[model samples]
Target: MSTNNQNDVVSHAINAAQANAEDSQAQQQVEELSSMLQSSTADANVDTSSEE
Candidate 1:
């Protein structure tokens, strides 16, 4: 392969790895937010029930 082609391939590989890492990080953030929401909702429910 030509030097230009090799460079392009390496660039693409690096970009793909970075994209995958970003996606994984985003997924982790979503999971953390969901867990926090669920925990808060459960707490609110308990408080409401106790007041009844």
Candidate 2:
């Protein structure tokens, strides 16, 4: 392959890898937030029940 073609391929690969890493990080954050919300909701339910 020509030098220019090789450079383009490498650049594309790097960009794809960076994007994948970003997506993974976002997914992890979402999961963490979901877990926190669920925990808080459960606690709230317990408190309400006890007050009844």
Candidate 3:
């Protein structure tokens, strides 16, 4: 392959890796938020139930 082609391939691969890393981090944040929301909802439910 030509040097230009190789460089393009390398650049594309780097960009893909960076994107994957960012996506994974974002997914982790989403999971954490979901967990926090579930916990908060459960606590709120308990509070409401106790008031009855």
Candidate 4:
């Protein structure tokens, strides 16, 4: 294989890896936020029910 082609392939692979890492971190943050929201929602519901 030519040097230029090899370098292009490596560059593409590095970009893909970086994109995947960013996406995974974003997904984890979303999951964490969802969990926190659900917990707060449950607590709020309990408080409302108790007020009745």
Candidate 5:
């Protein structure tokens, strides 16, 4: 293969890896946010019940 072809292949691979990393980070953030929301909802429910 030519040098240019090799460079193109490497560039594509790097882009794909970077995209995957970003996707994983986004998923982690979503999970963390979901957990926070669930915890807050539970705490709010408890507080409401205790107020009765």
Candidate 6:
């Protein structure tokens, strides 16, 4: 193949890798946030119950 085609392939590969990494990071963030929300909700419930 020509040099330009080779460069295009390389560029596409880099972009795909970056996209995958970003998606993985986003998933991790969502998981962490979900856990934090669940923990905070449980704590709030416990505190409110104790006050009654």
Please report, in order, the local distance difference test score of every candidate based on alpha carbons: 0.60, 0.60, 0.61, 0.61, 0.60, 0.61
For residues 1-52, what per-residue lDDT tens digits would candidate 4 score against the true structure? 5445654665565555556656778667655655665566567657866887
How many clashing pairs per prediction, in order? 0, 0, 0, 0, 0, 0
Model 1 TM = 0.55
lDDT of 2 by residue, 1-52 (tens): 5445654665565555556656778667655655665566567657766887
Model 5: clashing residue pairs?
none
TM-score of each: 0.55, 0.55, 0.55, 0.56, 0.52, 0.53
Q: Return the number of clashes found in candidate 2.
A: 0
Error of 6 at 20 (Å): 15
Better of 4 and 6 by TM-score: 4
- Worst 10-residue lDDT window, candidate 4: 2-11
Residue pair clashes in candidate 4 = none
Q: Output candidate 2 Cα RMSD.
A: 20.0
lDDT of 1 by residue, 1-52 (tens): 6445654665565555556656778667655655665566567657766887
Please list the residue runs of candidate 5 whose C-alpha ends up more than 4 Å from where it truly belongs after superposition. 1-22
How high is the lDDT of residue 15 in model 6? 53
Error of 5 at 12 (Å): 36
- Candidate 5 per-residue lDDT, tens place, 6-37, comes to 54665565555556656778667655655665
